[model samples]
Target: MSAPAAPASRADWPEIRTGIAADVHAFAVDDPGPLRLADLDWAGAPRLSGHSDGDAALHAICDALLSAAGLGDMGEHFGVDRPEHAGRRSADFLAATLRMVRDAGWSVMHVAVQVVTRRPRIAPRRREAEARLTELVGAPVSFAATTTDGLGALGEGDGLLAQAVATLVRPGDPARPA
Candidate 1:
């Protein structure tokens, strides 16, 4: 038989999208807190300053998910001006974002997040963080951390930063094997 006919168009393949995002928050000098990051509570570390719990990692992940789904960023969905979001948990943000992504007819394939911080070391807790995030998002989640090598405000340990990338695909798409 002759060579199989070339796919009629790109539409023959399932749609896939990727998104990248980042977030940063400075330590809260006024608020003494049980620091929350990657959905875990750090008893001794100081908390980050923000209207929410200041879990930069989760916030970045939410933004990435929203971006991938073409649903806009976190600010539009949960703005500081919204009094209800004040002091909200980043986990709540994550759950809401996941819901939004699902409602958009897309499912998360995976997510990778990198945290930039000088203190409250991440290696010791990477596995735990990954497990928790994976459970929350219903997808594979990777968590990693790095330092700025003493270059800026982040290097000074004044704040925490996080970056995330997410992949999404339509559920049950022919291109996606069960």
Candidate 2:
């Protein structure tokens, strides 16, 4: 919820900006099922995802980048019903988002993402998650892990939530190159 720092005025320092995007999925619970967040190795936990290939991490990051670029959100760009994305890798969505931003004359500074869950403890997969995300944006990005801490419906462990922030370098900045 922190405000994005001024971009044009803070040229000396990397211009700071914040964009938020969130998503939730009603993952059908099943033991020995596929856990579909980046094809992640789930360490033998319950599976929860609504999409054909349920990837909470990729979905959240896609929205973040689109929001930061002042582009319409995910639904506006990628339709959930489209056959192109059917059984598609969530990573592909993130890659497409990067192409959109670059075409708009901007370079990615970094992205920060949060994956929310109450089971199986996601801390172990944090590094692998970030590496994959960084590749999506074509730059270094941050992926952080946090739990609902038993605070809300998510805290009670009903579903999962992912939130992300994307910072972009505007086009034509002398100090930045796309």
Off by over 4 Å in 2: 1-17, 173-178
- Candidate 2 — which pairs collide? 27-49
Off by over 4 Å in 1: 1-9, 171-178
Best by TM-score: 1
Clashing pairs in 1: none
What's every prediction's RMSD, in angstroms? 4.2, 6.4
lDDT, candidate 1, equals 0.91
lDDT of each: 0.91, 0.72
